[model samples]
Target: MVVVDVQNDFCEGGALAVAGGAAVAEGITRYLREHRAAYDVVAATQDWHIDPGPHFSDHPDFVTSWPVHCVAGTPGAELHPGLDTTGIDELFHKGEYADGYSGFEAHACGTGDAGAASSAASSAAGRPRDLARWLTDHGIEAIDVVGIATDHCVRATALDGARAGFAVTVLTDLTAGVAPDATERALAELADAGVTITDSGTPS
Candidate 1:
């Protein structure tokens, strides 16, 4: 299972707060606590931006890059307070240099490339093996993704998971979107790409 960016920055009161982010955090914690056994290996991704380049623009344009957020070593970069990560097997950090919306852009810890780089270009160039290889190595054939901002990171993760040939499902109730219209469009896009959209309360 993949839990997409549930970081504080995406939640309420953070720099780039998304709607219902806090509720998503709490719900995910509860779901994991009750259904941890349903998943084989659980992993999570966070927007661990470490550099303030084009990804953090002075003038705002929320579509690409808007405000500075999820900077490395800051509290906003951490997971939401309501979320319990005890069951997570690994953590992948992304957006260290560029605008990383997909978990695949992240590198798992213990890899040499998992840290703040001197520059955004260097960090992108230094990215280690992607999430696909890691999933394949661990024999993960399917992925259930749940998290904040359904219109952005969650959408990207699910699409990438599908592209990698993994059966992907986005737990609708476990996600919060930045905007309702965009979220609807993102869901439609995912369905068009063959990703399943469903509520987490129901069984697959």
Candidate 2:
């Protein structure tokens, strides 16, 4: 399962607050606690934007860029307080040097090429592990996705999962969106692309 960007910066009272983002975080935590055994590897993605760049613009276009949020070492960068991350096997960070919406863009701590990510991030151990590589290493053929901003990160992650040849399912109930119309449109687009759309009650 993939939990995408359930951070404080996307939750209520955050700089880029998405409606019900906090509730989604709580819901995902509960789901993991209850259904963790249903999956083999449970991973999460975080928008760990560190430096000040175009992604953290003073005047964001809201389409291609956003406000300063999820900066490294800041409260906004941490996951929501209500989220229980006990079962999370891996935590991938993205948006450190550029604009990143898809969870696939994140690199697992200690794995991959390690590129320009800070030493503090690499201190977690392991190499860089992108979502595709990680899933492939684990022999994952399908993925269930949930998280904040259904219209954005969730959408991008699910689409990328599908593109990566995984059977992708978006857990609608466990996700919240920044905009209703955009979320609806995104869901439609995913469906058209052959991604499954289901709620928690539905069997995987």
Candidate 3:
């Protein structure tokens, strides 16, 4: 499954926005148009949170309490209008409980029988399934990921996908940085860990 987090709150102008976030949507669209039939399923995750959730103040990683962003029902929480979600078959919402960063921790991947089953059998026990599990269950042995904020959620998801044993590839052109240096560092880390980084021109 291709995970896209091209939501307004992660885009150029919303709270906690990422520079070049708008480009992710367009790049993913182009990729999908070329390879829509290669997969059996497509899924996406949105950072759907509510105001005053524990995520807003519970973590020291946040510089200051962020103005509530991706709040449910808010314009900033909507998927960026530029994304072609018409190809997506499932939408998972994360950060509802404020413990999620990766899309695999989102509700659709987190609360199902597959999660329960995997939790019982794996050493990565008790962790939610998110996108990685969804892909594994559907017999997808590799993933080509593209989305917003390469240093944050995108990095987390790609790393987790690699750890989950899928051959993970990050489409660099279909992603944007949360911070240039940090994103570069994250990509380097992913590369060291065996996640392939490539432009959208690379075949899925």
| Candidate models: Cα lDDT each | 0.84, 0.84, 0.74
Q: Which candidate would rank higher by lDDT, 2 or 3?
A: 2
User: Can you write out model 2's per-residue Cα lDDT over 73-149, one digit (the tens) per residue?
Assistant: 79998889888877877788887887778999988764223333423444554455577887787789999999987
Q: Cα-based RMSD of the predictions, in order?
A: 5.1, 4.6, 5.4
Q: Write the per-residue lDDT of candidate 3 for residues 59-164, one digit (tens) a residue.
A: 4454324556788778998888878877876667787757456776774543233445544544465444556655766788988778876887788888888888
Candidate 1 clashes: the total is 0
Give per-residue CA lDDT, model 1, range 1-204, as digits (tens): 898989999988999999899988889888988899989778889888877478788887888877999999899999898888888777788888888999988777542232233134345667554577667767899999999789999999999899989999999999999989999999999999999999988332
How much is 129 displaced in model 2, in angstroms? 1.8
- Estimate the lDDT of model 3: 0.74
Off by over 4 Å in 1: 111-129, 202-204
Per-prediction TM-score, please?
0.88, 0.88, 0.80
For model 3 the TM-score comes to: 0.80
Task: Supply candidate 2's per-residue lDDT for 165.
Answer: 94
Model 1 TM-score, 2 decimals: 0.88
